[model samples]
Target: MTGLSGSGKSTAGRLLAQRLGRPLFDIDVLIEQHYGERIPTIFAHHGEEYFRDLESRILERTIQQTDSAIIVTGGGIVIRSENRQLMATHGVRIYMQVDPQISLERLRAQIASEEQQGKRPELRPMLAGPDPLANLLTMQATRESWYQEAEYLCVTNGRPVEHVVQEIIDMIEPTRNENEHAASLIGTPELSEPSTSDPVIPPIIRHVHIGDGYDTIVEWGGLSHIAEHLQRLSLPPRVFLITDSNIHDFYAPMLVARLRAAQFEPHVYTIPAGEASKSQRQLNAIYDWLVDQHAERREALIALGGGVVGDLVGFAAATYLRGVPLIQIPTSLLAQVDSAIGGKTGINHAKGKNLIGAFYHPRLVLADPLVLLSLQTRSRTEGWAEIVKYGIILDAELFALLEAHAEALREFSPASKALFCQIIARCIDLKVTIIEEDEREQGRRAILNYGHTAGHALENASGYGEWLHGEAVSLGMVVAARLAQKAGLYASEDVERQNNLLTALGLPTTYHGTVSAQDILSRMQLDKKVVGKRVHWIMPERIGQVRSMTLPDELVTQVVTEFFGAEEDHSHA
Candidate 1:
């Protein structure tokens, strides 16, 4: 078991070992036992590097020697790549996840209780700082990528030790059984049979199973096979279809017919097509429609349109009788790539975009790239902005892919279907990984909003529909790139590459419309990401790398003004 200090790794391991009738081996204890010295004393005399080397050797030796044992390791063990490889290959590695704040409190409580016994304090060399909580958070962020490499991640905060242990066991046992079953079938005739389909072919269906949430399936022709996929899920017979007028006119009949063929009842409700539909008045209308249709908790809500429809319908699902099951059928490229996957659902407030919202994960997300063929050029190109954001933040390989296929993507050509499917799947995977790590916008997830801070401000400053959400974000990303360069946080060439990519995709790189810089800044102040009146600007350090920093108000204003045009008034209105 591995996790942050005071994350109950040792306790859980001991309990799990006892329950399993296995020996419990604590690596730290073994080191101290071997040297006849305390951990802190070892660290103080020999330094961290020496301790780490000794820890690695002992951990490898213990794993090699014991065929079946519960090995509780130090949190820092993951820092070494060799240790991680050994753990991954040799045994099931379980990560005990805990909130940094909770870990800090637990450590403090342990320290205080230990002091009462008149014993020497358990000195955590890493926790030696004026702000231990901050230190813990920093350390957690640094090691999170490595911790996620574990086979299973168990959230241990406020959970009973027995419960956490049981969860770990439950997660591991199924995998062990599956492995055994697969081993038993290895020599079976089924494996030797020649298949009609190509064995080397990549799967068209990209299935992302979010833990206890829902599965997200992205395929090229998924919309037509919606009923087939729905049959596999545990959805109710009745589906409340929430779509926009434009999407209804184009795709609703086929979907309704398919559902009917499957003997599932589908009730359709089409709001006017646009951002204007995602308002309180429209939301009330949806509630009225649901009530009129006698929608029940057991019934499912299907959001079938772009981000606007998905957000509106998702919010309705979340609120109407305290949420019903939601299935996202994202038609537009923007929805398929970004909004439809994450559980962020809400209507725009008069004050700002997504001002009213809820963290409601959907029952399923079905993204069909075939729908993009029907999208107008503007809508399709605008969606590319969000796709680019994913590249800028998390995946350099995706960024390169976009660059390589820039022309084909711009035309939305028939040949690009396979490439687009891969793009959508990659983007969805990146988002799912981040969402799994930080389900709420606690820390790491904020990177997903790389361009939204300025983008949302622009959308609010201008009328909501004046600039499409993706177009605004495209502009926002450019502004962020410029700000990063100005602040010397990002390289000039990287910014240029971003601009070139956006320009090549026919996405807006600058706000051409007339909007006051101060007004935009004022709207940005209302952003949810703002902490203590400071906006957390997500700056691109390089492709696939971004960092969030709270910039001074003046610096933000200057960046906004420079990007929107210097003639715009910066003074408060």
Candidate 2:
């Protein structure tokens, strides 16, 4: 079982073990007992890398040693691919998918109770922040993509623990036997489906202008439909197409071709793939390219690619000629669902991921779901991670859809295509609504960062390239669940549900690498989300809902240590 620190994974796991008459092992407590010291001390003394290695080694041994015990995992255990593989090979993995709102409430209640019991800690990230809510929002946005990929996906919406547990039992019971053969059940194939040339545009639900009943699905009818959306924008100056090589090949020509067809002179600039491309060097290169192309402030820059391309291009657009009009044409799932809609764009810095950027909203966003059809399977799967985020933050119905039809939606089939379009459209609407209400991430927007507090730090510490944005998010979501559990907002069943969903979607639910608690917490401290040196975690109160909460630095550190205790040995500093 896995979830945020205060999310109650331990309680649920123990209950499940008791019900099944099996032994239960809480990975965090086990690690602490094995080390004969607190996890926070280990992090303070040895660092995250060392802790991560030890966690992986110990986890390997534990799984090998155990028979049919109900195992409770540290939140960070799913960060590494190896740990996920181990879970796949050994026992069933369950995640507690709770809401940030509930997590905050639960933690508050637990802390109050604990205080009554005279328990105390030295560091607390939440206690240090001035605007704890704002800091919490930042964490949610950063890690939003990770928590959405859990396998079982149960929403802990402040319900009784027994009810949540019953739901999980119904989903995972051996008698039902659905999950046992889940691997063999394929949804749709990559190439067997229709290509972009075979356009399937849906009616314009939001912008219904140029074409009478024009069809536009962000991924499939992407650039081809941009001209119509631009018409709504009153034909902003010359357009600059900024993208990476991967995206340039698939849709740049089509976008530029259509732009020229519409009597606009368009220029295309390409960058390499990976987070490394989002740097000062790349930014300077883009500056030179924009200058060479005579890009003016009037001409809008269209960001086309996954999150990396979107962030880099969006930042360039933000800085170039004092902020040019930006039009977002997000091609990736992550982009379409999260980054593309919010206007939060920026590049990575050596100090951290997305360390530098701007919150420049696009004049308009064009999401073509068909584009996902051509996306690599891993990339497409990564996108699903964000789709799951929509469910975690504000749409329980969407969560049910994902749980019910993940297989069907895996490949971009016609059914899957429509589902993707519907899902993206809904997410876009939700995001736009949040942005409109809290463009600066003041209140409701903070809920969007449901699982990102630790997600970003994990990305930064792992060296972004080591894990795909979605992969990091996948593991990060579990960490958030564990943290939530620690905060006491949920039960173990919620964590289990999240884990089942993630495993079903082929996402990680544990961290098994060599990153220690202190390093992760330090990197988190460096995050833009932290205010007044405080760490705010955006946890869920239920599926489709979230809440921002301020935690004490000591509690945050302890939670981090508990999550990373599994990796205490053989890890680097």
Candidate 3:
């Protein structure tokens, strides 16, 4: 249930849940309970981003915990695409649309009644403003589309709670029967999908549009719709798909089945899953496979796994026949948010990660958050390390969202796919902006290396694949933030906030690699981004902003020593 702040959604949802014999999850109350503070206090202290983050986290949790419940969301809940998508998928979304005057009147009457009973009413943030009705009108206009997307709309302007509850109950009963019948038919695939030759994928379905015919498509059941996305790109129907052995059995077959149905020929090559497979050896093998198939330059190369597969396949697409169309279907969170978006494709050297490659953009990038549900908890949580970097470097609101939803994002499952989708879309958008400004990392793009400088060094010093990239990055961010504070370019409290946020998300904020700090510092020199014999350091000035500059060798060496010397064994992270 959602609508204006005083639209009686809370009262209606509670009574409706009781009548229906289901649990009621109120997002506003949950926030108050979790933080030990009321809505207005939370908003005033943490700002709107923090409050919205909390709102999103609470909404996601409630959606996950209950299969059958009436959820009462705050007025501003519809402002977030993730929350709206989740609600649409999980429950019968109902918008309580009523006059602002009537809603305010009802709120005031309720408050007076509570005071007469010697009880204090919970103050709403929306109502705390000087001109609440104007705020309500503005919010309603902003979220009009979101409200209209709901399955049902309820108006309780002159009605009682019982009447509203009854109307909602009548609406839900028929849908329950239809949904149960549909669930039994879930795994049954359509023998044939209507083929479209329009060669134009709608912008709505395509999540991130990077202009010039390049788009990133992200959706839950998007694998089944690959033909539709590909049709618009107008590439040769005969495509080569490269994926890791671990993922071939799961997604490759499904994708192949769909492609073949659409009259396309798809030849899949499965490589071993790990950092080792992203090498010249695998590249040679792929070249051999493509040669045997007589693959042409216009045909597309589809990458269908994590970073390892993406890097290897992307390089093959870049160098093979001088350049072929490329499509990325990144299944892992790390790849979907970081590796897959940037056109930087490469293989690791004996000494470093991504030491060899090219700046080749994929014609299309398709990411399914549903696929992430198949990943282990550790694999899923590690992706947030790179995601946190986006928030710190370019977007403070994104950072706060991460801070608020750290736990849910860490333990993501089916219930959290929509939020993850939104998160992935956000990361992709940020990377796209940077890529457009400096596709070759000439200037602003270098800020993306915020945590990656020390992060890559850790990976190199610890031995490739010894420490996951995200773990190294988690510690790298902490070290970078500390360096910023020490240089007097950042606040100590800001450093603590970054550290705390990383820690809360189950990311390691301290180094525990066995390699000596001095060795790690030396490896930092070998970074592919080095120029003028100086390493570019991306340091934070606050939660959302950062500047790129090379720090003093002594300061860098001392910080490295401090981290590498720590006794804490969060390396297990």
Backbone collisions counted per model: 0, 100, 0
Given candidate 3, what's the lDDT at residue 292?
A: 88
Query: Clash pairs of candidate 1?
Result: none
lDDT string for model 2 (548-567, tens) is: 77876777777778766644
Q: How accurate is candidate 2 locally (lDDT)?
A: 0.67
Estimate the TM-score of every prediction. Answer: 0.64, 0.62, 0.64
Q: Model 3 off-target regions past 4 Å?
A: 1-211, 566-573
Worst 10 residues of 3 by lDDT: 189-198
Q: Looking at model 2, report the run of 10 residues with the lowest lDDT sum.
A: 183-192
Q: What are the per-residue Cα lDDT tens digits for candidate 1 across 218-327?
A: 76657777888788886788998878766653456556657877888877777778998889989998898899888999799999999999999999999989988899
Evaluated at residue 266, the lDDT of candidate 3 is 79
lDDT of each: 0.80, 0.67, 0.77
Q: Model 2: what TM-score?
A: 0.62
* Candidate 3 C-alpha error for residue 183, in Å: 20
lDDT of 1 at 141: 97
Per-residue alpha-carbon lDDT of model 3 for 488-547, expressed as tens digits?
988988788788888888888766556777777888889867888899899898888999
